[model samples]
Target: MARFNGTMVALHSPRMNGRGKLMFSRAVLLCLFLVLSSLPVADADAEQQSSEKALREHYDLQEGKRLYGEYCRFCHGEQGKGHAFNVTPPPADLTSPAVQRKSDIELAQTIHEGERGTAMGSWKWALSKEEKQYVLLYIRWLAQSR
Candidate 1:
């Protein structure tokens, strides 16, 4: 038997003493402390990642609105009702069912490759892929706002 912190502890081996028991208890406590301390850090990391994603999405939408104002508003009009400029055949009313019915892929293609025989020109040389996507997002928002 060995006395550790005024408590009796039975030992089967002669090599084991109060000091060894104390060291083992300390080691266990250290391991528990390390594990518990890491939990909050992991939770904080997940929260930060979620927050970053939300902020990125919000900024992307804002950029989309800005792009629409700069590029599409002249032809599509302020509200996408079209014909802001006096172009022949007039630009398509973006909020109309005919235009909104088109899939995102089709809309993106038109933005990238231009509609033939119309005033709409290809933006492929002018805008990056991400910018095109942002424009598409703005178009969708325009439809929904109607």
Candidate 2:
């Protein structure tokens, strides 16, 4: 039977060695490693979720920026800091504690349903569910950075 010597996986399958043992062929092991790498890293600790969120979002956060510009920049301004308008009260300060304190569901609802008594418009039609998630993650990243 092929054996793992604690250094490297044996390249030969046990089937070839005629020992009747199930072996992890190098190709199978490589494929498993690659597949696992693409998936989200699971963690048991809640604190790790925040950092994992950043890592996952970092991959597509730039696309999130594009979504932001397409859906948010006009009113919320660059980075959702509300600098694009000189209007009274201005748009929502995305980085503010009040805004940042919102849960993901609240944020998504705000974006999808728009706020009452304001110029903000619902983006439910403009962005898909996944797109909304990306936007939210990007907004969170922006808030965290500042």
Predicted model with the maximum lDDT: 1
What TM-score, over all chains together, does every model reach? 0.65, 0.60
Give candidates' CA RMSD values in order.
Answer: 6.8, 10.9
lDDT of 2 at 62: 81
Which whole-number lDDT from 0 to 100 does residue 62 have in model 1?
A: 93
Candidate 2, after superposition: displacement of residue 18 in Å?
Answer: 29
lDDT of 1 by residue, 1-146 (tens): 78999999865456868888888778879999999999999999999999999898889989998988988999999889996988887899999999999999999999999999899999999888999999898888888988
Clashing pairs in 2: none
Q: Provide the clashing-pair count of each candidate structure.
A: 0, 0
Say which candidate scores most in TM-score.
1
